[model samples]
Target: MTSKLTLSVFTAPSRPVNGPPAIPAPQGGWTWPPTAATLIAGEREAILVDTVPTVEDSRKLADWIEASGKELTTIYITHGHIDHYLGSSTLVDRFPRARLVATEAVARDIKTEAESGNDRDFYGQMFVDELCSTVIEPEVLADHRLELEGHDVIAVATGQSDVKDSSYIHVPDLSAVIVGDIAYNDVHPTLIGSDHESRLAWIQTLSQIQDLKPSIVVAAHRRSDATNNAEVLADTIAYLQKVDRFLPGNRLQCSSLSR
Candidate 1:
């Protein structure tokens, strides 16, 4: 199968690219060090999967987008994590014409996180302290499929899984799916602010993705893997089941208790 997206790992201080692998935390070790967002450019227009955690990282993505020369028509926010959405402002600054596409739930989550004063600290830790103030509000709320650049992109909501307001962006034409934190390649999946239902939703979402028969799957957090959709779906389901089994109970524990 032809690869629809290419993944690149950006350099960071805490998560240096060439340094020794970061040791995982005792309970939930750092599965994968946070990297700048993924950029998805097609024949007609460019679509940024998720913005990085800092202005500098976002700038890198913006620079690539500008170099590509294709019109950056949309910025797809896969979830509400600060790392995914905070760098959106940098992209907006560069591509003023690009529409910020996100679900209404994500918009509400961003607003709530900003108002709660947790956003600052979240970005401050993932990125640098200087970019803690950068926040971009969504300009478009997409609850369903939207046609753009000859592709019918559907925004499937998988909320409260790895993050609140999580979503999966599927491009049927390309036979590809941009799975946010729902599935990670070679890394322990993040489980923050989630519940049993959310975990089940995440698994169900992966099942739905498998049904899409995507030729390529772009995981928001890891390097893109050239594997069948079923393999990716099975891996995600197994990971979630692992978490479920590790908990040692009939009722899967909540995100808080799991931690």
Candidate 2:
């Protein structure tokens, strides 16, 4: 078996972002950190995992994939968050021959987010007009596996992480897993919907990934200063643990102070 498939990472580098009024802008202010997309390529074919949020970002990703010189077979979406698939229209249009596919649950969530206006209403300030006006639908995968150069790339349903119905990709031939937003490298994990109970679920999700024992863990969103390795999984687990400890108290303290 050929265990030498190549993997490349493309990050949509950060742009300046001013926190909304409630959050209040500090001295230097915040920046929207980069988003990641991965390409697992072989001699003749490839599989792309996830995508960036904006129209322009998707165009760049298309160009990057074109430069890889491998026929893009399928574009895999790991989960349902809009940002992960917002650029779908552009990608689909660009790669007309490539199929856009995801787990059934995730495909449903994409439709949910698109119709709910949650992504457009909140993320508009950061991405502005970059968000697409149309939705690019994806087909639900009949099986949890994607073939890259004829090797089986497995998709394991993690149940929940930052969002419900999240999953990570396991490439057994390469000893790697392309984890969506379940784990972060240096960047903070988003916990808006998280609480004590859901976080425990996330911890279990992390365990599911660890059980695979992958060496090269591909984080869906990452910072250049960080690394792609199993260690980041432990770090993400620790961050969620801290959130469980301090976040609630901090929220309560703020609530009390406001009152």
Give candidate 2 misplaced runs (Cα > 4 Å).
Answer: 1-3, 248-259
Model 2: residue 128 alpha-carbon error in angstroms = 4.3
Clashing pairs in 2: none
Model 1: how far is 123 from its true place, Å?
Answer: 4.2
lDDT tens digits by residue: candidate 1, 58-122: 67777877877777788878788776787788888888899888887887777777678686764
RMSD of each: 5.5, 3.8
Model 2 sits at a Cα RMSD from the real structure of 3.8
Q: Assess each prediction's global lDDT (C-alpha) against the native.
A: 0.64, 0.79
Q: State the lDDT at 5 in candidate 1.
A: 35
Pairs that collide in candidate 1 are 24-29, 25-29
Clash totals, every prediction: 2, 0
What's the TM-score of each model vs. the native?
0.77, 0.90
Model number with the top lDDT: 2
lDDT of 2: 0.79
